[model samples]
Target: MRLILASTSPYRRELLARLDLPFETLSPQVDETAIPGEAPPETARRLAAAKAAAVARREPDAWVIGSDQVAELDGAALGKPGGREAAVGQLSAMSARAVRFATAVTLQRDEERFHALDSTLVRFRPLSLEEISRYVDAEKPFDCAGSFKSEGLGIALFDAIESRDPTALIGLPLIAVAGLLRKAGFALP
Candidate 1:
């Protein structure tokens, strides 16, 4: 069966490429707005499923994979920064705190559907404004949730990371994705 990734994120695309499976990418075009009183995990899961379903509407014959990540701090969800000011503010607010990254993945094909969620805990070190400013300037992670990229120089901002799948912090959860794909009859060595 043909495989399709329903996301435009480079990080997710790179991670999916590691599976060595030939797949095409299509923009999901799903609204990512969080629902009122919704938990971070649920938001991620819902978005993931929505993305897959959006693309599946166009390609019912292909297996579509959709994924999303949300950074939760103090029971609130922190989305992408989208600019230097927002990135700095997000980093500052998250300094010396533990943030839970809820990454969800969904696979859909015709009547079949599979789903998974990976939660990664990242503890940020106490960061001064200068440090946050420098990191923001160097990495420009404005488009990334949590205002940092755990796979890049942003790793230095964390004091500790606890996760079952390290790649989940980057965006896509490979371990969970592999399991879902395997259950869908895809062979993976």
Candidate 2:
């Protein structure tokens, strides 16, 4: 079966590659703005489906994978920091706190769909301003939600993480993705 990933994120692409499947990648190019008052998990689910649907419209025969993640602190969503100052601020606010990361994934083929949502709790250790700055300077996680990369130096800032799938924190959940693909009739060991 023809397969496609409805996003251009390198992280997602890398995670999918671990499945050892031949697939094509496309930019979903959908607006990612969260609906006002929408919960974090809802935002993730909506965006993931939107991304898959957007690409499925173009390639009706191919199964497309779409995924999105939203980091929630105090009930509000945290977005990609986008710059140094914002990264620093986000890390500071999250210091000594437990943040929830809601990640959603969708598999779409025409009108048919399968979905999964993974929730991860990241407990950030109490951090000093100096530590935040040093980490931000070292990792510059400007493109990641929650202002850190769990796969990289950002792991140092966390006291603990609780998740069914560790890959969810990196932007894709492999276990969920594998299950969705298998349900969609793809072969996996």
Quote the lDDT for 165 in model 2: 100
Candidate 1, 59-149: lDDT as tens digits: 9999999999999999999999999999999999999999999999999997689999999999999999999999999999999999998
Give the number of the best model, judged by lDDT. Answer: 2
Tens-place lDDT per residue, model 2, 2-84, is 99999989999999999999999999999999999999999999999999999999999999999999999999999999999
Name the weakest run of 10 consecutive residues (lDDT summed) in model 2: 6-15
Lowest summed lDDT window (length 10), candidate 1: 143-152
| TM-score for each model | 0.99, 0.99
* Global Cα RMSD, each model: 0.6, 0.5
Residue 2 miss distance in model 2 (angstroms) = 1.1
Off by over 4 Å in 1: none
**Predictions in order: lDDT:** 0.95, 0.97
